[model samples]
Target: MSQHFVLIHGAWHGGWCWDGVIRELENAGHTAVAPTLPGNNPDDDLASVTFADYLDAIAAVLEQQQEPVILVGHSSAGFLLQAVAPRAAKKIAHLVFHNAFILPNGASQLDMFLPEVAQILIDAAMTVATPHGSIASPHKNVPILEDLIRNALMKDDSTEVQNALLSRLVPQPFVLFNTKVNTNDFLALNIPRTVLFCKDDRSLPPGTFLKMAQSLGTYELIECPGGHETLFIAPKIIADALTKITINPTFHAIG
Candidate 1:
C-alpha cells in the first residue's frame, strides 16, 4: 500500500537533506514532504528563531496534509516528534525516529548529549555572540565543526559526500537544544511508532539510540547498516526500511 511520509531533519540540517530519501520513496510509489523548519532556513535571522517557531512550522505542515502521514524524525528531530505529536496527533499515522534523540519531559537535547559535546555546542554559541549582545546575534545558533561531521555524523560516507553535506549544513539554533520540552501529552498518545536505527552510527555512545527508543513504551524496531547520516549517504536503504516499517505490521517490537 502507498504511504505518505513527512520527513523532519535534525540539527544543522534543513529539509534538503531528505532529498535522496524522498526520491527513493517516490520511486517506490509513496509520497513524502520534507519541510525546512523556521530557524534552519539559510536566509532566516537565527537570533530571532525560537523553539515555538519550530513547533509552529511543523504544525502548519501537518495542517496542510490531506491525510495522516507517517511522520519521520531524524537525529535531533526525534524529540521534535515528542513535542509536536500530541497536538497534531490526528494528523500523524505513525511516528518514526531515525537514529534520533528522545528527551523526557523537562529535559533538553543538551541534557542528552555527552558533556564534552554539549559544552562544545555551548561554546560555539558563545563565540558567535556580539560584543554588545545584540538581539540579532548569531549566538542563538550553535555552529557544528567539520571534524565532528566527518568523524561522527557521516563517518560511513566518502570524503566527497562528507564535504558536500558539510557545505549545506546551517548552524542549528541553540535554543532548540537548550530549551526544555514537555512530553507529558506526547506520552499519553496511543500512536504506533518505530525506531529506525542505523547499526553503524557512532555519533553518540553505543546503545544510546536504542535506550532512547525504548522510552516510547512499545514500538517497532527496524535496524539498518550505516552511520548517523545514512539517510543522506544511503537513501535507498533508509527509504526501504521506512517503507517496510510503515506497511508491515510484524516488524520486531520492543516495550
Candidate 2:
C-alpha cells in the first residue's frame, strides 16, 4: 500500500533536509512532501519566524493531503509536530520522531534537555553575533555545540550536500525553544507513534528520547546507527524503519 508522508525538518534545517529520504520514499511508491519551515534560508527573514509560523506550514501541507498521512519530525521539530498533531490528528495516521524531542503538555524543548545543556545553549546565544553587528540566536549554529555537526554536517558531507544545508541553516527564533505545548489533548488522541534513535547522535542524546517515550506511554522505539543528522548519514535505515511502521501498524515497540 502506498502511504503519504509529510517530513518536517528540525531547527537550523529546512525542507531540503529530506531530499535523500524523499527519493527513497518515492522509489518505494510512496508520496512525500517536505515543506520549508518559516525563517529558514536567505529568502526568509529569521527575525520574524515563530512556532506558530512553523505550525501553519505543517498544517498547510496536511490540508493538501487526500489521505491520512504519516507525519515525521526530526530534532527540534518533534515539539512543533506535537503542538500541531492534535489539531490534524484526524488527518494524520501516525507520528514518527527521528532522534527528536517529544515533550509532554506544558513542556518545552528546553525541558527535555538537561539543565546544564539548556544553560549552555542560553549562555552561547548570549555571545552569538551576526554579520550586521546584532546578536543572533545561538540555535543558528546548533552544530557548533557538538563536534559531530562540525565534523559531519559541514565538513564530512559532500560539497553539494554541505552547500545546500548551509544555505538553509538560519538563526532559529528563541521563543520556539521556550514555548510550552498543550499536548495533553494530543496525547489523548492516541495516534500510533514511533521513535528512531540514532545511536551516534551528538545533538539530543538518545536517553532524552527514551525518557520521552516513557512519558508518552505508547511508542515504537527503533535504534539506528548514525548521528543526529541521520537523514543525511543513514537515509536507508530511516527509510526501512518508515516502511516497517507503515506496513505493521501494530508494531508499537522497538529499540
Candidate 3:
C-alpha cells in the first residue's frame, strides 16, 4: 500500500535537509513532503518569528493533505509534533520523533538541556540580541558553531560533508527554544506515536534521547544508526527505518 509522509525539519535546517530521505521514500513507492518551517529561510526575519508561527505553518501543511499522513519530526521538531497534534489529530496517522525533543507540558526546550549546555545556547542567543531600552532580546537568532556541529551532529561524516552542511544552516530562532508548551490535549489523543532514535546521536547526553522518548507513555521504539543529523547524513537508513516502523502498530508502554 502507498503512504504519504509529512516530514518536519529541526532547528537551523530547512526542508532541503530531507532531500535524501524523500528520494528513498519515493523510490519505495511512498510519497512524502518536507516543509521548511517559517523563519528558517535565509531572508526571513528571525526576530519577528514566534513559536506560534512554527505551529501554524505545520498545521497548515497537515490540513492540506488529502489523506492522513505519517507525520515525522526531526531534532527540535519533536515538540512541534506535540503542539500541532491537538489541532491536527485527524490529519496525522502517526507521530514519528526522529531523534527529536519531547518536552513536558509547560516546559521549554531549554529546560530539557543540561544547565551548562543550555547556558551555552542561551549565551549564544544573547550575543546576537538587539537592545530594547534596559533589556535585550534575542533578535539575530542562535548560531550553531561549526565545531559543535562537527562534534555533535555530524561527527562520523567527512570534513567536506560537515562543511557543506554548515554552509546551508541558518540561525535558529531563539524563541523556539524558550517557548513553553502544553500538551494536555495531545496527551489525551489516542494517535499512535513512534520514536525513531539514531543510536550514534551525541547532541545530547548519552541516553537523554531515549529518556525523552520514554515520556510518550506508550510508543513504538525504532532504533537506527547515525547521529543527530542522520536525516541528512544517512537518509536512506532513516527512510528504511521509518518505512518499517509504520508498517505495524506494536508499542511498548511505560509508566
- Estimated TM-score per prediction? 0.93, 0.83, 0.93
Clashing pairs in 3: none
Once superposed on the true structure, which residue ranges of model 2 sit more than 4 Å away at CA?
124-148, 151-168, 246-251
Residues 1-255 of candidate 1: C-alpha lDDT, one tens digit per residue: 999999999999999999999999999999999999987888988878889889889989999999988999999999999999988999988999999999888999999999998898777776754577634434557776788898888776899999889989988889988999998889898788998999999999999988877779879888888889888878999999998885443443764
lDDT against the true structure, each candidate: 0.88, 0.73, 0.87
Cα lDDT of candidate 2 equals: 0.73
Model 3 agreement with the true structure over 1-255: per-residue lDDT tens digits? 888899999989999999999999999999999999999999988879989999999999999999888999998999999999999988988889999999888998999998987887887887753354323444747887777788877878889889988999999999888899887678898888888988888888899988887768888888888888878877999999989865454554341
List the RMSD of every prediction in angstroms.
2.8, 3.6, 3.0
Candidate 3, overall lDDT?
0.87
Residue 148 accuracy (lDDT) in model 3: 75
Given candidate 2, what's the lDDT at residue 231?
85
In candidate 1, position 211 carries an lDDT of: 88
Q: Cα miss at 96, model 3 (Å)? A: 0.3
Question: What is the number of backbone collisions in each predicted candidate, taken in the order shown?
Answer: 0, 1, 0
> Where's the lowest-lDDT run of ten residues in candidate 1?
246-255
Best by TM-score: 1
